[model samples]
Target: MIFGNPGITYAATVEVEAESAILVDAETGKILFEKEADLTLPPASMTKMMTEYLVLEAIEEGEISWDTTTQISDYPYSISADPSFSGVGLTQNQDYTVRELYEAMAINSDNATTIALAELIAGSEGAFVKMMNKKAAELGLPDYQFVNSTGLSNSNLGENYPEGTEPNANNLLSARSAALLAYHLVNDYPEALEITSITTTEFDGQQIRNWNWMLPNMPGYLADYGYEGMDGLKTGWTDLAGYCFTGTAERDGQRFISVVMKTNSEEARFQETRKLLDYGFKQFEQKELFPAGYQIEGESEVPVAKGKEGTVEIEAAEDLTTPVKNGQEDMYEVKYNISKEHLDKDGNLTAPIKKGEKIGTVELVYNGEDNYKNLVTGKTQKTAVDLVTTSAVEKSNWFMLMVGGVGNFFSDIFTSAMDMVKGWF
Candidate 1:
């Protein structure tokens, strides 16, 4: 289950044919949907995302400039020269600037251009693979390993490697890890989207077309496959990996990242991702439950035991934004549960509480099922959001409690006398 919803059943209903898939919110890190997302698989050309990330990060750190040019080495040239490989058509000893090479790698899925950039960043493809693995670990990816800067496996390596190096060092990534990689790629360096979105560009005197089929105006595929707001990401295909895509789109202020792996056909990858994007946009919306420092909707102020103030205000530590399904907004409920220890025997908050102190937790629930309903049940329930308060409830003095107690005492005595007179009559 993802985001506390039944993911497998939902994905099947949507006709997602991929072996592994996931859709996530770009900003909130919420998993909207997923199916077999943790299974490891070959990434094919989609591995270039890491290649693009390291290069862009280096540029950001002032370690390298965009205009810095590098000469095409023999290894990279061999890969590009082979007619069987997808490349930017680089010739040996030819020099291309960093930005030019990156554009080719990202938009065209050029293996040779990627290796050249990898070598420039880490001095060798093998060493760059090490960097990729290190960065993967830093990103908290649960399962991932990189054998090469390029996604090519040993059998596909052809004659492109130096002696004594492992040829089978191919890149492996799970759908979860791929989505996380894409998340960091767009969040940390949104500018990369600018390059990935390019439909066509000139490199080495030849026009290169982007491999991502989801973009509009891609010749034969545009009419059936194009989607708006799909500015970024990469596509991959190999005999072992099948068709895989990591796509991101933005509409209004929201952005989503989706990954589909091991689909039946190239077109199927983009089509499946489009279904996920549509589901994300149409079914749910980000709603602000409470603004920062605003009092929780139904919770009462705390009565302090020994403070100068009669009552202390209760408030959320920060803004609460939850993505709820359409037409199910009324089913959204916020519950504030405070521990018994934090309150006196009379159920009033105790004194000596600090501001922002967590006296309780805030829970958000949505009551619905596959077709959507307004009723809350054990089986169909989902938690849309959860937050812990550093100080949701405040401390107050005993004065307010004593005053309330005296009023209740007089009211109870009067009620008893009235009941006795009615019985005698």
Candidate 2:
């Protein structure tokens, strides 16, 4: 089945306070709302979403496992020891497992642990940077560049910067690209959420908390920003890139992924995200516009040639249900697209047609003044359902065909003679 944009006209009802922002339907990847979504900017630690994705992928491919062990290098050790950067203070001589480091990076935004995981997977941070960019391309991210695994400015790495990158470069992504990346992450590896949803955990005998304040059960003053249904995403901040967040929430079986870049403060990012999510949940609802086996009037049957029946009935193969804006149900119309391959030159199905045979497709078209396009593919994707034959059509007996042929031959001559006589008058 094909999925399309919601029938409601695309409009932003909420005032999102951010440099760039986007809201997407997690199930369909549809852009429900966007503002300057294509403008590329620093993603800061939010860049770790790509790293998290690659790590999950590696574990799935058997190249590594959560139990895989590796030691911290001098570069990461030095970075970890710094109080200014988010880290758990790893020592060079100690061994750490992938699961330990991944939790720190995902839940706490631990920069040093992120570098350790990158090195473990690719043998060097430089090689992991290459992998990140290649995967970004494979994922169809429209605007993105990966300079390092942890989303730190290369200059911050000092002389230890990844071998192939410029000294001062930072990771970059548009709001749309970040949203799409988050969409693929949660959908492709849903297990990742199990780790990301943890609000706090222990590392190296010290308590560390997730940087995403919107998560439930956040400790201390962070609890004021708690949002229901919010879970497992990343947040980022740097002098060059202001506060940014990629947040996901699920309520009433509907999930939405939202991105806000360059907000003024940590609290502001969550505040803006709340606005986006509220607009999504309150403004729309899951609706079944058409039921399975629904037949369209005047276009539900196909003529059958030389068969026992003159025509065969067709209906939708499945239900057409999707997120629809409240109070806009009448803005949708259906269009039938019969398959020419299944018909002869006279637009009739051939004899011996089987039951439930697919013969065409039906699409739902939005009649609203404005229609939204998909974030990945910039086109108005219409929802389509398969059209199938409801019953079988058998070939007529040869004797019956001969009798009909004789009747048609005399009837044609009599009609022609009558027309000629009338013309003489």
Candidate 3:
């Protein structure tokens, strides 16, 4: 798609063959391009990202080890009809190691593998869903609700009722949630990449390939413009949702992710991600515009009361730079919005305020519009306040006294004495 006088958001206009998309800069966590990104669309096997996330988290906590082996319980297996599932065709009694199961899930997008991993780590898929939901909430992906380890619907498994008519614990997730899940997977679980980065693998004398068709294809039949460093991930198809893909790639040190759902065909899903990823990587370049410790040049002076220190120094959090293309830097500028609310009327120490405190934020503007470039990044830096001794306030410290400090302490003593004298009351 082409940019036609786009405004602050620079929102993409391209409608992919997929249902919705969210393309984010992996390194900076910036939304490079999006189409119906917030719209929750069903994610098929990509839901495995959550299953994958839970397994990795367990591994990190030392709750489970790669060498750990587990039983092929019918629980996670019944959710899949595909033979690649780790729990399926389980040699009917063989035990798979924790690491092996994770490999199955991440490298092969094996539904049964995911469930077996979850169960081995957390006792059961039901229990693991607790961990999954808890982790997603912690990561602030409130839009997602995981129902199971595999993306199978409980109702769909009725035909295979290995354990009888009871429903199987299937799973569900949205495209954006899955993208965040992938984001966490790539960034949080470095070990996972060891598997996802692999294009192909074989398990138990069975040759199974990665469902993520991005590798070995050179951005393959997807787009006229291709992305570089495209890695492995998951893909899914069902009668309800056409085809879905969740992919990640990197270029010039800037990593990005693309999530597409409900495409008309498997090829279409791949094509759309290629287009989004290509446009994203080619358009924006990462820049470390500001260092967190950078001390800004100037500060506006304010009134101050008598104190040991005549002036308190306040500095900007960092020097500022932004992500932009060639020749577009100077067109936009940032404005500081620090407020003097923390300062007293006399402009003296207010109980030793800390430096680098959230004194305020800065906003960036372009062409008379809020470029929304403030980035709203999380706490940039910690303030190392130089609490220099300053002269005491000349007037009565009523504020502190009111809070009943030393003065209150004495007043209470006096009051106690008076009450003693009137003890009868």
Q: Which structure among the candidates has the greatest lDDT?
A: 2
For model 3, the stretches where C-alpha displacement exceeds 4 angstroms are: 1-15, 75-88, 159-171, 216-227, 290-309, 317-322, 325-328, 335-342, 347-425
Instruction: Report, for every candidate in turn, its global Cα lDDT versus the true structure.
Output: 0.77, 0.89, 0.61
Q: What is candidate 2's local distance difference test score?
A: 0.89
Query: What is the per-residue lDDT of model 1 for residues 245-309, given as tens digits with 9 covering 90 to 100?
Result: 99999988898899999999987898899999998898768887556665554454766554445
Model 3 over residues 150-208: C-alpha lDDT tens digits?
A: 66565554544223224644445565667777777888875666678776567777766
Worst 10 residues of 2 by lDDT: 1-10
lDDT of 2 by residue, 106-214 (tens): 9989999999999999999999999999999999999999999998899999998998999999999999999999999999998888888899898889988898899
lDDT of 3 at 137: 81
Candidate 1, residue 424: how far the Cα is off, in Å: 40
Clashes of 2: 0
C-alpha RMSD by candidate, in order: 7.8, 3.6, 9.9
Model 2 stretches astray by more than 4 angstroms: 1-12, 396-425
Ranking 2 against 3 by TM-score, winner: 2
**Clash pairs detected, candidate 3:** 289-321, 304-347, 305-346, 307-391, 308-390, 308-391, 309-390
TM-score-best of 1 and 2: 2
